[model samples]
Target: MQPCVLTSTGGAPVAARFHAPPGAVRGAVVIGGAMGVKQDYYAHFAQWLSEQGYLVASFDYRGMGDSQRGSLRRLRADLFDWTDDFDTVIAEALARSGGAPLYLIGHSLGAQLPGLLKHRDRVDGLLSVAAGSGYWRDNAPQLRRMVLYFWHVLVPVATRLFGYFPGRKLRKVGDLPAGVVMQWRRWCMNPRYHVGAEGAPVREKFEAARFPVVALSITDDELMTERGTQVLVDCYANAPRRVERIAPADVQARRIGHFGFFRDQFQSSLWQRALTQLQAFRSPGETRDPADGISSRVAPGLLTAH
Candidate 1:
């Protein structure tokens, strides 16, 4: 992987990395990182995809990771602006692919923002890992109390006093821009998530998404419960969607939590399964159904909007 920087349409310098295969490329992929997570977290996964003959790009949002130029106390980025960052990266991936099909591997907050993509039609398909609504009530039962504390206490207090979320100092997640954290808190507090938080225009945009999406939810994920995952998938009212809930035992592991999917430890078992599903979309007129040829056990179809 080589270091790169992307200039968003809005002019923010987004930090990124690119992985290219030696031989012919089958497809181009843009790996979008989760909230408070840096692009480097997905570096190994991106390299693996490149080895499989795919050109892959992994990027960090403007206010996070290498993209941030200075102190978070002065930055003022919001979650919606992330759509612009994604647009820039996707455009770069498409340009590099020389017109090869482009796919997205979006994790957590990475997955939720795709509906806002201005070039949604350009995407061949999306693979959403551990994607779900952030509504606290919809989280895993065991984590709900913690979620409440985070939503009601930590976020507000920290953002108010520090001018940004001091997640890194608190050892919660990672440091976040004030606007991003507050906006996220608002969405998570709403039952409808971003749809409710942003109102009708956002809802319409989500309904406009018509691509195929495969949402992978881990049963052991303490952050997102089954209902949390389902709620986000349901928002894509016009997408052909499938939800696959995998238990750790199914993969011969004791635990695969919210962040484990991208770890190198699962590169052979879980990661390979994801690659198969992604590669399935490489050929024209290929099966678009998420269930076809995927090794992971498929849960009941979540929401398939016609």
Candidate 2:
């Protein structure tokens, strides 16, 4: 793993890390993180993907984790800037890919906003984990229980008081720029989510996306529900997609929440599952989409945690 810094299109610094295999490279992966998550949080997964002969890149959005330089108020970024950051990371991964198939492994907000990418055509596929539309009405039971207060009272009051959302200190969401929190709150409150709130242009972007997607939805996800996940995936109307709704028992685990899939303990199970699904997309040299098949290669071991 090598630490690096990337410059966003907006000319802001973005923190990132790159992982490469020792031998032949079969594919490339860009791991777009959940909101407030750092690029370092995915180090283990990136290392494992590299071991599988993939060129893996992970990055932090501005005002989150290592990308946040000094003060939150000093940062001028919203979700749009973060999408630009993701685009920058993807571009780097694609350049280093050397014609190998490049996939985006997006988590939560990471997946939701890919429609905004200017270079979506360059990506081969997307692996969405616990990603959702963030419509409060369709959120997971836990989030739905408190959605009103979070959107109406807390987010507004907190952002105004601090000039930023101190999610890390509050233990609500993670820390975020005030613009990000406000814009995100608007998305959550709207029944149609970001697309509905942002208007026709955003919807057109989603409609324009054509890359195949593998959406992994966790039944035990504390924030995203099956409906929410599907809603987000459905936004990519022209894209061929396979949505896997998995409960803990389905993978022979005690519990796999929204965040648990990234834990090292599930490396052999969920991680390998992701690898197989991405492999099914297309290998290094070939270009066209394969059978969209994942089950034949998903081993029996996936049913048991060894």
Candidate 3:
């Protein structure tokens, strides 16, 4: 895997890893993951895609992972910042590959970011893994949800008021960027800011997107409920679209809950399915579509929707 850095207009450095597939490369895929998650976390998954004859580039957004950190003191992380950062990644990837068929694989927030980049024509396909409408209605019990909301409001306030706010330990992850955490707070409290669902009209920035799309969500994702996934599915009004759902039990014993989908233990489980969806679009003489995003394979599974 070769390492590269994309410098964005915002003066942030985006770290990227590029893996050339064995033999002749059939296609290329750019991967993006959830918040506070690093690109290295998907190393096994990237290797798997590379083995399947794909040149894959996985990268960390500015202020996250190996890239430069943002001003945490100001709590300024926003989707626009990451979107611009991703724009640089796409430009560099295309320039380096010389216009190879490109696909996108975005998990969680990464999945949603591309929706904001619909005007960019650098991708041929898209795979939205565990991407959902940004509503926290079913995130937890009413009491727990209320507590979370209260904390969302209180923490930022206290942080500004007293310079520090109590934070929960992220699940095996690092600290959340202040901007990202604050944006999440606004998103959770309102359903309109949700992705892949009814909300603000497609921004003028994304109207250029007309490529084929596939959005998938897992049933057992503790962070996003089935309803939230459906909301995302409903947002895509374009043709050549497909939506897939995976119940936790369907993923064998792997328990592909949220982050588990890309983890090593569940490679053959969920990752295989994702790959199959990608391969389905690839043919011997076919060039890549600019909207198709993911290129993973799928193995046997019994994912039934409730």
What TM-score do all the candidates reach, one by one? 0.92, 0.92, 0.80
Q: Please provide, for model 3 over 1-306, each residue's C-alpha lDDT reduced to its tens digit, 9 standing for 90 to 100.
A: 999887876567789998888876667788877766789888989989999888888888776768855444544556667777777777766665555667788888777677666334656677888876666664534334454645466647755653323243323234555555566666656664544232445533333454456777776676766666655544444324556778777866646777778877777777888788777655444554335543222211212112
- Model 3 residue runs over 4 Å out of place are 69-71, 74-76, 138-147, 158-174, 194-208, 283-306
For candidate 2, the 10 contiguous residues with the lowest summed lDDT are: 297-306
Pitting candidate 1 against candidate 2, the one with the higher lDDT is: 1
lDDT of 1 by residue, 90-146 (tens): 988877777767788999988999999987877777899998999888988887868
| Alpha-carbon local distance difference test for all models | 0.84, 0.83, 0.65
- Summing lDDT over every window of 10 consecutive residues in candidate 1, give the lowest-scoring window: 291-300
Q: Give candidate 3's TM-score.
A: 0.80
Q: On a 0 to 1 TM-score scale, where does candidate 2 land against the true structure?
A: 0.92
- lDDT of candidate 1 at residue 249, scale 0 to 100: 93
Better candidate number, 2 or 3, judged by lDDT: 2
Clashes of each: 0, 0, 24
Off by over 4 Å in 2: 283-285, 288-306
**lDDT of candidate model 2 versus the reference:** 0.83
| Ranking of all candidate structures by their lDDT, best first | 1, 2, 3
Model 1: what TM-score? 0.92
Q: Model 3's lDDT to the true fold?
A: 0.65
